[model samples]
Target: MSRVLLLGGTGDALRIARSLRAEHVYSLAGLGRTPVDLACGVRVGGFGGAQGLVRYLADEAIALLVDATHPYAARISANARAASSDARVPYWALRRPAWEPQADDDWRFVDAWPHVVAALAPFRRPLFTLGREPLAHLDAIPAHQHWTVRCLDAHPGNERARIIDARGPFTLDGERALFDAGGYDVVVSKNSGGAATEAKLQVARERRLPVVMLRRPALPAADREFGDVAGVIDALRAQPFPIVR
Candidate 1:
């Protein structure tokens, strides 16, 4: 009789929920738009903080916790670690394999967001995908620069970018078509760290466009690392969860 509070926003997390559906009662916690075909119960947004999560663990009797959030979401990872430890509960972080720069990939992996904004100085015909909220980061860029930016919202923000609002896990065909059609010379995106959003990178590779990519932030120490939901299930079966995800 185990109950778990799951921290997820990745495809793998949903898969883990499906894999363990027959055996465990799970409560999924995530951000952004809720998925339509998820297989478990859910909560959304920050868990108040470490103390809030601790309270939740005690009140809900969440015997275990699994984080499947985006790898770049460092804040949640830290919160999960501190909360789980303070509550004396077990936890795990499900992370996908990070994309590396291949010979074909002419990516210049920028270590920070500000650097990506600054790259605009030397480049043009740029395609951007820093997600929805970081649009302001582009404000510091020169106004004369023309950019092709994408988002999930229709009216993202007023900026120099020609905003393309669409959804993720985009097809390579569409991504490539957009880049080619737009005559993009450079790609600037975050290491958001998930396949759904990584499609853009693949598209960039196909076009051989130069990239100004952001690196992923750190996660708190976890008991184990899972590349997929199947790995998470296997770990839960084998031993206690990790310290962070």
Candidate 2:
């Protein structure tokens, strides 16, 4: 049976990883908690780049490469496609659908950081769900603004900003409490289409707050693309290797 290499970090990726056989490998970028309960082999950290990943695939005899990374992870996805092509392996991607704006949503889409900053100028209290990107701009925060940033890990934030370290699969009540406590006038987010962190959007909608959305990046094409974990699982089952249930 051929071995599979799954590049993953998202919750959706974890679900697919859980279904892989022991011979298959799950790779992470070493950003958050590494799961110890997985049946397949877990490889943490990067593979250098596309060339390095190609070496890894050849060294480990990886026959299938699956890109299950976050939607914002364009570079990694690109590398995965390039590496898979060079290694002569099939490349599959799980492209989760982006969130659609509801009729009540006040979503302002921005392609870059400067635009996000411009969109945020009118709001005094902004809740940033764009991860650690805001942490870098803490010192640049306007005197009138107080930034609240949420990411996977905790960090020491300056007086102008407050960093909250938390993982998602967040509930509506929890999001409501967060919004209430923060008293945020605006929300800064990526169009990461998944249920895990979607409650914030609902909370924003309820409060009638404007969300400064970072536009999704264009990703490389794959031999097969799946919209959800179940689709990927089904595809894997049809592959030559037997999936570990």
* Top candidate when judged by lDDT against the true structure: 2
Tell me the lDDT of candidate 1.
0.71
Model 2: lDDT of residue 155: 96
lDDT of 2 by residue, 102-128 (tens): 999999999999999999989999999
List where candidate 2 sits over 4 angstroms from the true fold: none
Top TM-score model: 2
Clashing pairs in 1: 93-245, 222-243, 222-244, 223-242, 223-243
**Where's the lowest-lDDT run of ten residues in candidate 2?**
236-245
TM-score of 2: 0.98
TM-score: model 1 vs. ground truth: 0.84
